[model samples]
Each structure stands twice: as C-alpha cells, then as structure tokens.
Target: MSANADRDDRDLEADPASSTSGPVGVPVDAVCVGCGRTRVTRTSLEAMEIDPRVDLSDLDAADCTSFKHVCRSCWAITWRNPIAILTGLLESERGE
Candidate 1:
C-alpha cells in the first residue's frame, strides 16, 4: 500500500524502511529532508537508474547508498528535472 506521507516518523510504531511490516505496521521513519514531509518512500539502488533525474553512474557501487527517497514535491517539481534537484543537493551539501 502507498504510505501516508503526512504521518510523523516519531509516532510510527514500525520500521517503514524494512521489507516486512513491523509490530505497528510499517514504521514510518523516513521524512523528506527536503520538505520535512513524511511522503518519501525508499527506492532500491537498482531503481535509481530508472529515474532520469538520478545519476549514480559516477559513484562506486559499494559507496552508493542503497536507498533513495524523493519526496512528492521534489519528485514533481525539482527531482523530475534532474538539474534543479542536483543544484539543490549541491547547495545543501555545501552548507549554503
């Protein structure tokens, strides 16, 4: 089932990132760092290649994090375009 992104991670009773549902149903701990929304769903590393906006080619396979979360707003507005989100991530990474 599609998760409700509006829910707070702190209140979740299960580990949403886990493949199997936890004690309190899938625990929702993933909140979008971009929008502070809980709408981000974890995507496998293999799935990243399918997304045109994401570029993992430069990074080593072992160094790359297995999970990627693109929030609704980012996916729709910034991430869908690639360059926009890349700039955003770069700026954020630079502590700007």
Candidate 2:
C-alpha cells in the first residue's frame, strides 16, 4: 500500500516485455527494428562491421533518422568498424 509499491506495480504493468532481473533494461531510447531492442541507432548500425549489403538493408533508416528506438543488444553484439570508431574518436579530439 506504500507509494513505492504502487509505483513498482505501475512500472511492471507499463512494460511487460522488460526483464525483472537482468541487465539494467533502460526504457528504449530508440527501438531497433532488427532485433526489437530499444537501443539502436543508424550511426551505431553503420559502425557495425557487417557486410554493407546485408547490414545496411536491415536498417530502418527512416525511423532511425527520425529519432526513434532501436535494438541496443544487436548493436552491442555486432562487430564494430574500427575505422569508424577511430574516426569518431579523432573527430572528438579535434572538436569538429
């Protein structure tokens, strides 16, 4: 009957797909259409070292650019393009 318990119940009801005990499942900032994870981005997808033909086709480019949710788990597992990472790092270093 406490306020905290009431909130917990509400939270549970709000998102049935979320795991009760696992990685901190932050609410989807951007849902990835590929794996249905709430954590993906076009840039992140592009940075993945997948065959451009296979991977790019899987991307929901319209949604990603519109600032929607995506699959963080997929992104996490995908091999990242080192050149992209290095370029990003260099860009930051240069304050570009």
Candidate 3:
C-alpha cells in the first residue's frame, strides 16, 4: 500500500514504506528524506537530477544525506513554511 504522507514519522507504529510487497504491491521507486516513505514524484526526481539545491551541495557526501530533496507531501509543507523546514535542518546540523 502507498504511504499516507500526511502521517508524522514519529507517530508511525510501523514503517509504511514497507507496507507494499511480499507477493503483490507497487514497487518502491525511491525513499523520501522528509517523510521516510517511498512515495515520490517523478518530476521531483527529475528536478534533482537537473538542478539540486546549492546549499545542499556542500553537505558531506550529498548522495547519502539527500538533503536536497523532500517528498511531495513535505514539499507542500515546505512551501507553506519554508522557514520551519530550514530551521529544522539547521538545528539538526547543530546537533540540537
């Protein structure tokens, strides 16, 4: 089953990303850094290949960090309150 992107990661009892599979289910394309789910937009993945965030480039081994991308759900949240998202990222880097 596809994940409910609206759900908070903290509240998830089980990894929704793993819900699908084991016989018959949609294949997981890629995981989301923001939501930890396999739900993602083709456009966003394409965008990542085309132009990633400049600020995220210096992040150690960006391929592992994936700080440049967010899920469609988190993208919506980011657009609504980018300050919050940026602040959270900064705080995490600060070990806060």
The C-alpha RMSD in Å for every predicted model, in order, reads 14.5, 14.8, 15.7
Candidate 3 regions with alpha-carbon error over 4 angstroms: 1-28, 44-46, 50-96
Candidate 3, which ten residues in sequence have the lowest lDDT sum?
78-87
- Please give, for residues 1-96, the per-residue lDDT of candidate 1 as tens digits: 235553554446445545332221211234444665544243333433433234433433333332344566666432211121123333454483
Task: Give a tens-digit lDDT track for model 2, residues 41-61.
Answer: 234332332333332224333
Q: For every model shown, what is its TM-score relative to the native structure?
A: 0.23, 0.18, 0.22
Worst 10 residues of 2 by lDDT: 20-29
> Mind giving the per-residue lDDT tens digits that candidate 3 earns over 49-80?
32333343342222322324345767633211
Q: Candidate 3's C-alpha lDDT? A: 0.34
lDDT by candidate, in order shown: 0.37, 0.37, 0.34
> lDDT value for candidate 1?
0.37
Clashes of each: 3, 9, 0
Query: Once superposed on the true structure, which residue ranges of model 1 sit more than 4 Å away at CA?
Result: 1-28, 44-66, 76-96
Q: How do all the candidates rank in terms of TM-score, highest first?
A: 1, 3, 2
